[model samples]
Target chain A: MKKRKQRVNSFMVNGLLLFLCLVWTVPTFGLLMTSFRDRDVVSKTGWWTVFTRPDQAELTLDNYEQVLSGKTITLVDSKGNQQTVKGDNLTRAFLNSLTVSIPAVVIPILIASFAAYGFAWMDFPGRKVFFILVVALLVVPLQISLIPLLRDYGRLELTGTFLAIWLAHTGFGLPLSVYLMYNYISQLPRSIIESAIIDGCSHFGVFWKLILPLSVPAIASLAIFQFLWVWNDLLVALVFIGSKPGVEVLTQRLLYLIGSRGQDWHLLCAGAFISMALPLMVFISLQRYFVRGLLAGSVKG
Target chain B: MAGVRLEKIEKTYPNGFKAVHGIDLDIRDGEFMVLVGPSGCAKSTTLRMVAGLEEISGGKVLIGDRLVNDVEPKDRDIAMVFQNYALYPHMTVYKNMSWVLKLKKKPADEIDRRVRQAADILGLTDMLDRKPKQLSGGQMQRVAVGRAIVRSPKVFLFDEPLSNLDAKLRVQMRVEISRLHTKLKNTMIYVTHDQVEAMTMGDRICVMELGRIKQVDTPTNLYRYPANTFVAGFIGSPSMNIVSARLNFDGDTCYVDSQNLHLRIPDDIGKKVRQYDGKAIYFGIRPEHIHARETNPEAADNFFNMEVSVVENMGNEVYLYFTPGNSQYIARIDPDIPVRSGDSHEMWLDTNYIHLFDGETKENLIYKPKTQ
Candidate 1:
């Protein structure tokens, strides 16, 4: 009876998980199908219709090509005025996203890892208080800092550049990055670090040769998080870099594709899928590290 | 290889808890010195101070003739094997052993040669490519040792290296480590709470308690003549039985009198303990020293009858637990002896091997051997 109950319980759990998975994937699946369907069919019926009326399974790359090439767009500015923006620079916007994200991910992680090693292992005055201050920053809302930072960036003439967004994203990502890296690095066996020290490794040598290599899983996981965050971020880019045609990221261009009236459904579907592509690939490729890194220092190997 | 010297070394934490009192010790070159003590005895603290892992709150630590108080662990040229093995989980055995040489920028061929040599010595040649997580506990421990061996450091410090293994494996590794000491011939300072390991592996054992050394002597002397009651009870398995008693001298002979037993002290021991006459003293006798009267008829000098409360058959011998008056005592008798709980038997105490401690100081008054 106990075994039968356990079997039933596990079956219910599996069923619930399957239900949740379908709830999540069904909309994405619809968007994917609609992105491939002809524009007329997408307008005429829901995306599920393609499955029943197999004859309407007409698929084309026209929407993608149109979205990728140049096209006019309408966007609402911060002062609540609608403006007509020219040039559908989707490829340029995609490159802009890459430009903003790569450094935003790499710089913060590199800096955080160094800071984490110092905070975790190196003994110096005010180490504990400084670490506590960094951790306390985790609770501070980023929204409060945006205006003051943008005002300073304006005065410094740093606004509306890829550098501004990169700096913004790195500043925003640093606290959690340091916290996560510290949690993982601090739990590393004291003996391993001591052994490295005794093995003639200086602080930088230990960090570069030992700590960094051993922290691949953690770094990969953090990279995925930071990349996806900066890639999908529309607000930070709009605030710092603006929706100017050439400087705009994929997410900002994606909003431009929607237009102010939200009537370009077919183009919106295609552009959304295009923007989703890189992050999906990244998450899939590094999903293993995600789980391993989360569990890294929680248990002893 | 270089000897290690700790001169008046001490450790006091920031919170002002003194973990190690002022200690002076000289570990000879190529010697295997074991620091044995119970938990909170600060044995590991002293070893870490010598390794330069812990800061010396006071005094000096010298490796050879060099004062290493300000030296970093790497510059001190010493290797240590931690209790948990402390192998880098990500690195293969070869990389773990050769990382030091790589850090020093040794020639590629020389690094390879030294790593292979150390691996061969540790029986880890075939496992050089395996990561620490891929190896078993013993294998990981061997890799830790191999990492230390590749450096060929002046002194090898081990902090309870075998305490994590099972009993059977612990014994096996104990002998293996002893053999490693002979083969390497480096001055080694090992810290452990197990006196058996200290006894079997150490050329000399330093017994400590409460951050103070009780006695530092060769294993035989430590066992035969412990300086105080703590060492007497700590060094031997089954422990030496201690009971409250009074030593009285009737001018002709000296006798130790406890509740239900009156034992005449042998002349050799009595002469040494005679100064404490008419004073309370702690009587200590090892379990093996008490025998069944029937086995040795010559044990007639100090004999008594008592009801056995418990009997443990250990195949070769039997342990009889009994209460004579208010004190409980254990006697190890031959297995042939017919002793059972609730049964009465005649037992003889070998006064020649007895230990008498001063009631006030708890210092061994009967046998005070010179420490080496």
Candidate 2:
């Protein structure tokens, strides 16, 4: 009876997990199939129809080709006025996203790792109080701070530049980054750190030679999270960079592609997949580190 | 190698708890000193102070005549092996051993030579390419020792390094560490809770309790003449059995009288303890000193008959547990003796090996052995 109950429990758990997986992947699968279909067919039938009606599976690259080619887009405003907005090329927007996200990811992690090591290992006055202050910042919603930050950026005359967006992302990302890195780094055995000190390693030597290399799994996982966050972010870029033609990121470009009517679903699907390509590759390549990093400090070796 | 001198060292936390109370110790050059005590005795705290890992709240710490209280651990030229081994999991054995040399900017070939030499000494050459997680507990322990040996520092501090190993492995590593001390000839300060380790390994042992040093002496001297009741009971395996007794003098003979048993004190020990006549005192006797009456009738001075409560046969010998009056006593006797539970047997106490301690203070009253 016990064995039968266990089997039933396991079966129920597996079924629930499979249902969640399908609920998540089915929409993305539809979007992928829609992105490859001809524009007229995408509007005429649901994406699932391509599996049954083989005629609708006539794949075309015209949506992607037109989106990447860069042309003038006609947008209608709320008052029914037509405005021509020149669409930024997909390739340039992709490069701009890289310019913003890479540093935004790298700079915060670099600063947070140092802050985390100090918070975790070094003894100093007000260490606990300072750490608590940093953690408290985690609860402050970024939405509430955006207007004030944009005002400060305007005062500094740094609006609509890569530096402004990079700095904004870094500021928003630092608290949680430090908190996470501290949790992982502090769990390391104290004797190992002390042994390094006795082994003639100065503080910087210990940080550079020992702590950083040992933290690769954590750093890689943090990189994936930050990269995906900054890449998919539209509000921060739209507020800071203001949808300027040359400085617009992939998300801003995708928003421009949708315009006011939301009639360009086929182009939107193609542009969405294009923007997602890099983050998807990154997550796939570093999935192992992600799992390991989450479990690292929870158990002893 | 240099000696370490801790003069009136004290450690008081910010919250006003004193962990080590004014400890004064001198570890000589090329000597093995073991600081031993039960838990919460501050042995590890003292070792850390010497390693520059803990801040000294009061007094001075000197390494080779240079005051090092303010020096960082990296500049103190000391190596320590923690109880958990603390080998770097990310680095191979070779890298773990050579990282210090690399930090010092030594030539690559020199680093290789020193690492290989230390690894060879520890018999870790075959596994130098493996990481710490790939190694067994004993292997990780050896790598920790090897990492310390590679630096060849002035002093080696070990904080219960063998406590994590299995019982059989602990014994094997104990001999290996003693051999390492002989080969290195460096001043070593080891802290452990096990008195057997202290006895077999230390050139001089410092027994502590409640953050105060109880006694400091050689192993044999500690066994023969413990300065206080705590050391006497702590150092021996079966522990010295202490019971309340009274010392009485009759003409020239001295006798110790308990509630149910009366024992004559040998002349040599009686003379030293005779000043406490008619006074309540604590009498201590080791298990081995008590013999079965049938086997050693000639050595019997204080004879008693008691019902045996339990009998443990230890192959070559037997342990007879019994209650003589209100006090329980264990006697290590011949296994051939037909002693069983509920059976009355005659037992002899060899009075020569007995110890007398002050009833109030528990200090040894009969003898004060000189420490080496």
B69-150 per-residue lDDT for model 1 (tens digits):
9999999989999988877766778888888888888999999999999988889999988877777778778888998988
Residue runs of model 1 more than 4 Å from their true location after superposition? A1-5, A37-44, A51-60, A71-89, A291-301, B323-327
Expressed as tens digits, the lDDT of each residue in A1-301 for candidate 1 is 9999999999999999999999999989999888887767877888887788878778888778778876545689999999976565589889888988999999999999999999999999999999999989999988899999999999999999888988899899999999999998897778778888888889998899778977888899999999999999988998998756678888888887775677677788999999999999999998887565432221134
Q: Name the weakest run of 10 consecutive residues (lDDT summed) in model 1 chain B.
A: B363-372
For each candidate, give its TM-score against the true structure: 0.93, 0.93
List residue ranges in candidate 2 displaced over 4 A.
A1-9, A71-87, A291-301, B298-301, B323-327, B341-344
**Cα deviation of B20 in candidate 2 (Å)?**
1.1
Q: Kindly report the docking quality category of candidate 1.
A: acceptable
What global local distance difference test value does model 2 have?
0.89
DockQ of each: 0.39, 0.40
lDDT of 2 at A280: 90
